[model samples]
Target chain A: MASFPVILFEGGDVPDSLAYRAGKLGAEAYPNVEFLDVAGPRILMAPISCLGAGFAPDFHGFIEYRATDQGCPLTQVMVDAVAAGGLCLSACTASLLACDPVQVFCATVLRLAPSIDAMMVELALAEAVGNAVIHGNLGLKSDLRHSLAGLVEFNGRIAEQLRDPTLAARRVQMTALPYGDNGVEIQVSDDGDGFDVEHELGKPLEVGAKSGRGLALIRKVSTHIEGGRGGRTLVMRFLPAG
Target chain B: MDIFTDSHSDGTRFTLKGVMSFRDRDAFSVILDAVNQRAGAKVTVDLTALEHVDSFGIGLFLLANEQAVGVGSSLHLLNPQGDVSRIFDLANLDAILSLKQTMPATGATARNSAPPRRIGIDYRHLGKAEDGSPCVGFSGRLVFAEHGHFQEIVENLIANGGPRVVLDLSELEFMDSAGLSMIMIAHEEAEAKQIALVLRNPKGAVAQLLSLSALEFMLEA
Candidate 1:
């Protein structure tokens, strides 16, 4: 692969100029970009997360984070890491919802670049920070019931839809079920000998793990977790983010 | 994809309106970084309009989650429409990333407290399957030559429980070490949890995978 610098951008709609200029000027990847619009807060981390992993970086750094209708806390976390690392960072007034105080934590791997164009594609630079903060507080900060309710509200408003609407809708309908103060029910079913729990849960769901760390994070934070081939179920008690 | 933002005096909120996949990482990265400047503020990611997500899509989210925590803030994903939810579930990301639904046009945002989502097996609590038992019901496909849908299977089991688990190998046509390991992982998980992790009747390709691993005897022996 050609040696290229990691270009992390704030998530939002990238104007044709920056997108075109970046691509034309040798940009390796976009963590989140869509169409001509780079709805971002994405990463072009270290040319590659690992050295010599041989990822088909095909059209990297072009992630399309479609959560504009709401807020995304994850976007802020990713930005803090990328920008905090050694890379170029930029932002846009439009990308920001408002100016609020936010702090993101990540191991220092990439550089942080603060720019105006960055905002156009940035998810948390200005607009997304608050959402991330709220995500941590929604459920856990309140009583158990409120936490669960906050979770449902969280799920209903931000999480799945932004990642993949089709999948999010299907999952919400198939898996999640609410039963009053009891909590929210999440069903996970599959064909294999009931999937692997040791690999996905109780442990970090990062790289090597089949399902990865995100799975572990969601499950851990959730109130309850369950599932099986005969049809499994994940019952989240709906606690606020702790 | 377009970017939408809702601003408040204290902070700002953003909604990304488009398909979330590998194609848009660059754009997404920039936006997420910008959000980090503000510490401990609330931001929301609305997905009532998202369409797809793959490995790259998953990566984008992982990137965002990392950034959210850095500056003392968090990410909030909202209103996943369709296909989007399945992507998360398949990736088992539903556990970490919130997958919200649009309350019926009923306009009743049932702010009620959440209840525990339960899994009551419809099948009887049948004991383990017989040796070389013929596999029966099966759904999903091979993810890897060895493991295939193994990870997904375990994810489901974790969120839900089954009286009897059926690893219908009838439809399965291949296997490998990864595949076998996945099965073992699931088996172990069930045992540890004291749940009945039964490998239903096995045959053909499905049977071959187990036999090759010499797990057949251990499974039913």
Candidate 2:
């Protein structure tokens, strides 16, 4: 089971620049399958045939190749596979503010597990990306939401920060991986200063409490939460009952 | 999010369609401004069509409640269903805002009975304190997302010749680091004007945060 081959499929729309970055990040496992063109049914059938050939036969999951282009259309075969209870994972590297990473991530997760509550997934992803953009990359404090003037100032600062080449160029890399038969792990990392995860986790958050509620909710819903690289990288695991 | 307003003799009613999240801040602000303008009128916000609400949206409701109180008007939340209501219940907003299943019938006698007051934010104009000093009372969560507006209101009160202000946080449920920063900013602003800004009754999370930050001296008896 440990020798199960992890396949990687590259779509036609992926740009050369993004491909280079993905390669440099070691986004995919070595000697895996790669599909460059979606012009034929082979791209969709390849995974099924691989499974039929007893290659990672016990493994029933999909890992999407990460790239910049979001226009990679899903085929009926892929949808059918997910519907048949096969887990699906997708990875994407997005710009700090240019892409709606939450939407894309949540949509993919929902498709993978349609039985899961939509709001729960949406909230979790929103908090993840929001933290990555506002607190991680932009270095905005959570308390800035306390006042209208502060919100205005916060917005202004976000705009100003994004105008800086160093800040704007920072990327947020997100990867969704299957953990077990019933669990999914989402890892989001931002290129910014991380915080004291232990200190934040130590704070006592009462139910109905407003401050730090998002992370608290995320903690409640996720099976396990792990932080690394000074809290710049967060991995959340969710096991929705099928 | 789309917000539609309808005016009636009793008050104005706003209907919110679609998700009411942080993304709808502009639309929420429009509603807040409209409600503030109609102070003294019974303002009702119908969330029956609302699909979802985030923490920031919930914070906006708390702020609107404070604004309503400031203008002598009342704000009522009408018919929040599914996720919208669940988020409200989870946050215990029902303890703070007036939640109604249905709106009052038009042309009916206006109900003069005040709604139950729960643990929420409110501002009181204290003409003078026990020591013959001017003061004000602020109750509820003074955390981020609500801090800037809260600061502005406090600043305006201070600018209006109130040299001394005592913000009452007895009912405050929570205060984040941002809230602490705002308080410090207010304290400094008051100091520059040769005024005293005191925080009264810091309890619960507010007290814990102040103590942890080693700024408990801001609290007064």
Candidate 3:
């Protein structure tokens, strides 16, 4: 029998329906699961003790709540993971305020493998996020980077998209999972129209070619790459030198 | 990215610090504008402090080189280090640009008092071709920084009314995508002028790239 704990806050903004759903999901996933309401004074102490005992919750569900404050236990857990080089999964809304997803993802991975080549990691992340931002969310063509006028137009389009709330509100999520003892699997996905991954992948790199180098460069740096969601999602595996 | 410019009687020196990528497009444009303003004046760009560069940055260098030709001046790159230097090597820019390990001494007094230019390229005119048309010979690497000089030389040859312009690349050791682009542009210009632009003796990686791109038609036996 497996057991899991679920935290429920009384004054938190999480809806009751969401909590019910989380409970149902947990019960269906696990045979023996306990939902712990940490709102009461007595129950709060119990949750704190569980956390002190290194009982990491398998599933943490927060609905319609901001967890930016350090006081949030879940947020603290993520921070600790980043500092101690542990597994962390994060999802963020695609907005200018969220910063570059590539930079954030690379920074986290760098913490795990400090000896890895920084430039290689940077190039891989840049290519991934660039594909997501320009081709995915903004719906810009890669060939636009071929000429000066086209590049200018591309930048202008990106700037315009950034200003539109409807476009900027789309979500881009990145997940860094452990592959092996010293390998990492990075997945980047965006909510946009997928591209022709097969066509892009098949194109050969030629001299004097203006565009179509980003994916090639990414593939060269990563150990393995796979595309999904009609090419809206990119999964790259990198092995850092031990 | 930070661009600092210092102008003297010898030339205008532009020092770039930080990563040169798409994010620095506006800043790079400003540098291009400055290069355009100083037409016919020698321009030197120092990239020792640059940490990284992307494809856009490489394209921008080619664009700036083209602009430098329009103004009748030449541009040179100095002191590329780390990944910045590696990018140039990977792009095989040595054959197309005038890349030097250090700058030339300006004057007797300046040679001792001033700092060496670090890396510089010298442009030499190779006189007329077999048909009495203009022949330009480049001896060093021609990377992004040397595109300006390469363009200026080609434009000057075109202006001389040569039926066929021969570019002697026997001594060139490397040529990157930017260099290839410049050559292609020159070829187009020559075609427009009804003149044949011939690439003479492209060796090593330059030959490989040209052949791979199926641009061997421009090569001369």
Candidate 4:
């Protein structure tokens, strides 16, 4: 079977701009991503800014382009190929701060998957970071935010916990990898005690419920989701327009 | 943070300078108190010189507006530039707070002075529609970064609102879910005020987003 993320060339010819940049950077492949497309992951390549070219819905892999192809409008075309899905051609990492995780995720997503809906990513990432920072690292509960007075207490407790040297230093680790043919997989892991994944995922989405909305929202938007490392980590897969 | 307050018979204009963060909470509370003191008056918070604001600072503005609303007073924020403007745009604060687009000229106003530069989102209050409803045109990308300005423009158009208002999104190239949420919020808010918020001419990705988000009911026929 082919590896999950393969790379293919448009009409079997790598764009000259991409090849030149890769050669200048001393890379035989794309700068920030690794691939094993052969009886391996699907691999595809497109021109430097040719976001419109060669993204056949059936192809599941990163479309190779130069790092210079930053803000091209690739969403409409990709969304049209929903069944075929979309792919992330790049990857990035950041030291996550409690207050800045969403922004970090947003900036990284914009760089890696410019065609994806960033707000959707922002909302999902925000929930993941909140789960990591408040529930995992700091050992706080969602019940606090459901009440007005509890929210104040929760904020105070968070501030106090962050003042502790060890707690302040804890960071969430996130990694983005290509999933299936045309989706991005985001793995977010926290340093705190993990929760029960089965229990969490099994809970039915409650209407007008405030405390457990994050997991539900993540489940709704992601193509697939699973927990690992005793529930300390979550892998969320997102396809275009989801 | 520094505040230079100028009080007049009709209203009070507070010029805020320096960065506003959690440390300025106490000082901001005082400004909120002053705003409450002037009931039924026009209050302007000039932010031209204000360089930055964190989420906490933004919360203070929301609180200040709440206080102003309690006393039947109106608060208008003016001329936010740089990072201050960017933060406001990210949060979509203009949906609730009144934002002034132009500064008052001291003496003369030119006939054909160029319009202010379009930053993250380009918007123009296109006076009135043929049907007499207030019309506004929005072009370019509508995403999280442009939410505040987008809401502000729509809010201003609906201020002295008639039976309905028209939003022209024909030239709008893109809109994310955040932009869609802003339209929903605008619709709800307008409905509460007994005004119909009409969206017209959403093309390209903007149209797809609206449809994908299941908000076709919001568009005007």
Q: Candidate 4, which segments miss by more than 4 Å at Cα?
A: A1-98, A180-182, B1-17, B20-50, B53-221
Q: What is the DockQ of each candidate?
A: 0.02, 0.02, 0.02, 0.04
Best by DockQ: 4
Q: Which candidate is the best by lDDT?
A: 4
- Residue ranges of candidate 2 with Cα displaced over 4 Å: A1-136, A139-158, A164-188, A193-227, A234-242, B1-78, B81-87, B91-154, B160-162, B170-174, B201-207
Task: List RMSD in Å for every model shown.
Answer: 24.4, 14.3, 16.7, 17.6
TM-scores, one per candidate: 0.25, 0.40, 0.40, 0.40
Reference-based lDDT, each prediction: 0.36, 0.56, 0.55, 0.57
lDDT of 3 by residue, B132-210 (tens): 8777765544433243255455566577565787887765544544456556666666778898888888876467546
Write the candidate numbers in order of decreasing lDDT: 4, 2, 3, 1
Candidate 2 per-residue lDDT, tens place, A97-214, comes to: 4323244345456555555655455555656666776778778775654444555677577667767766655545555555575567666667679977667777986432324654
Interface RMSD of 3: 19.8
Worst 10 residues of 2 chain B by lDDT: B107-116
Report the candidate with higher TM-score, 1 versus 3.
3
